[model samples]
Target: MYLKLLPFFPGRVCTIQDPLAAAVSFDGTVSTVSDTSCSYSAVQDGYSYNPDSYVYVDFDAHPTVSGFVDRTEHVFKDTGADPVTCPADDIQGCSFGPVTDKPKEINDVGTLALTTQLGSLTFNAILGVNQITTLYTDDTLLIFAPVSKFDELGGLCGEYNGDPADDLTIRDETVTTDAAAFVTDWKTDPNCVSTPARSMLRYHDQTSLCSGVPQETVSGFEGMCQDIISPHMNITDLAKDECLQILCICNDRDIGACEASLEEWFTTLGIVDQRKKDPLDLAIELQSAFL
Candidate 1:
């Protein structure tokens, strides 16, 4: 089972996308995403939320993409009435500027890596970024959709699933050279249950829940808020992770590395939430200010 979907793993994105998601995110029960964006929650079937399968949902439209590599796109194709016209050059800081490369392609371990050791170090790669994509929030796109919704879609995510409501015909791994036959086979199979962890991606804007309104969005470089940390710095985890990084390469032990990986090891290892004033009372203040 583990080896089967290895190719689809790179889609492992931070499940939760709360503006204040530097903290824990909740689907029904709150899930803890590591410092990086990757989330780990048990499936209804108790499968690991590793990247074996990724679900894509349109934040605005709630549709699947044409293919796994083609999760929903902010950019759409040109059609009759509404032709694909280029955006005015004056448009404000546009995210995902163009479809030069697939968003998942940049993942440290490529899609299959999510199931393996190399890309599992997802935390280190995602957190290190200081730039924000075109997303409205800092969290991964995965969390925006509820788990049930994620399950219904072929779990192809953006660039793939178009409408979860649409009948999904994509079936299992029966490779074919015939375009029509391959597409038919690909679309007819029951959406493969890759055991994705929708629970972990339960991120939502906490401004309304915590306070009522979203706080001024801040980033690490902006220095308005800081990522929260456990009162415990997780020293033991830190040591273990260092050891894993050094030794695992020689041993080919990915699971062991994950076990020993540092706290927030799966997600953000170093990046902290943007800075905030009165840092200690920030949580309470965030509630007071936003919620």
Candidate 2:
């Protein structure tokens, strides 16, 4: 955003015409005349008069043109109407001026990243189990949309068919013994049935969700989600079952009595509210915060 201060001529009682049309001359003089007056050399004690105009001294004109120049005049000239008089309070010392460049959009990664990782199969599985009721918050649901390829792949259901040997193939090659055991007995593991497992699964699901989301939305949520989930899973070497367990625990966590804990998590971190902030500003803020 750019701000231009009107030339402050304190104690000078001069009638203000179209300030936008006003231009500064090279010799530190301001002229409210047309462009024709720019080259005029006639000066009497630092003041000049047009062929058929009133006498006025010119003020020093800065070579660098203000962005407000011409714009203000254009509005008045085109409309052929008087400029709206701004109230003193409204025009207080400084006012917001025209924006020079486009603002950046803000995206929510929590919704996007989580949605991608939880592909249709794994996503549906969690929803099917309904063990971590809190994970189904409105914000979470907003983040969860049907992913086409994932839906096609049949997600977790296609990969895990109740057989330890077959399920073992679905696990990442670097999976640890404990992680392998968890996947081998996912059907009967008490921990797998609880919130920690749910959080872990949800976390993995969210990673996939991030990949599928729109770039803008993905940018918003990706970094923060990584920061929050980093301690639980080694993103570089993902272990499917282990990741799933972590997601379950996180998802099942209760953030006090608030149902909109997911949304609150963002707001609490000073993330911009999507509804209130400009999209570009939000994106920039998120990027800056994460960086």
Candidate 3:
């Protein structure tokens, strides 16, 4: 009897290797079976097959048979349905495991805040915060001030020593229970800016300051994370470059020479000299100092 062989139809189980290099052996029946291929319908295992899926079957030997003969015929043999085994070693760029080493702690007090406060006080004799220098001139005469005073408030305010969450405080005999009254007394006093009391009260309105010395308020990790997350908390590269340019101009004592050097640096960095031909702006744009 010359029996015509029927091509393999849907419902045939097979194993396949996915494009992601994952070897998956499925014991499911195939669907949309065609002369060349079919879709896998996983039943015993959790796997699916599509047009892209390939099944392990030798058609030449079984010209009459249409289904898979045995489980071995599948691409991946039955390893007794268990969880897919993974490699023991760590995978690069994969954050699956706990961090072995903690990140180094960074100071919470930003350099910009410290620099602005110290720089303004040292250079201009003014107390400032957030780059806004508020000079305590006679126009804004203090109505009330601390009764007790110090020669300089320099040692009073600088860097935070404790947690960043806490306010910087200055502990001195001058600090009184009534801040307004204290200020009024100090300002009205004739010795406000004279010997034995020559006190320069630099007020940082926005900043929170207490009656104690500044202490670190944030941990290194917290500080670093804050800086990384907040751009305003730290000084920008442009500012640093501008400061450097200012220093150079001062050292050279020639604005024209400084501009020439700055222009050259900008050109090498492939940056436009914007901000009224500010070299620091150009450097900041390029985000590098290759020159």
How well is each residue in 1-291 modelled by candidate 2, as lDDT tens digits?
A: 000111111100111111122221111112222221121111011111111211111122213433111111100000111211111112211122311122211122111111111212111001111011001111121111112212111111111122223211222332222322322322212232221111111212345323444566444344444554344333342222222222222232321211233223323222212212344442233234323
Model 1 Cα lDDT, one tens digit per residue, 154-226: 2222112222122212233222222223222222123332222211211222221223222332122112111
Question: Which prediction has the highest lDDT against the true structure?
Answer: 1
lDDT of each: 0.21, 0.21, 0.19
lDDT for residue 116 in candidate 1, whole number 0-100: 10
Instruction: Report per-prediction Cα RMSD to one decimal.
Output: 19.1, 31.6, 37.3
Candidate 3 weakest lDDT stretch, 10 residues: 1-10
The candidate 2 region of ten consecutive residues with least summed lDDT is 125-134
**2 or 3, greater by lDDT:** 2
User: What is the TM-score of each predicted model, taking all chains together?
Assistant: 0.20, 0.16, 0.14
Q: Give a tens-digit lDDT track for model 3, residues 120-209.
A: 121111111111111111111001101121121211111112111111122232333332232222221223332121112222211221
Find the number of clashing residue pairs for candidate 2. 46
In terms of TM-score, which candidate is stronger, 1 or 3?
1
* lDDT-best of 1 and 3: 1
Off by over 4 Å in 2: 1-165, 168-212, 231-291
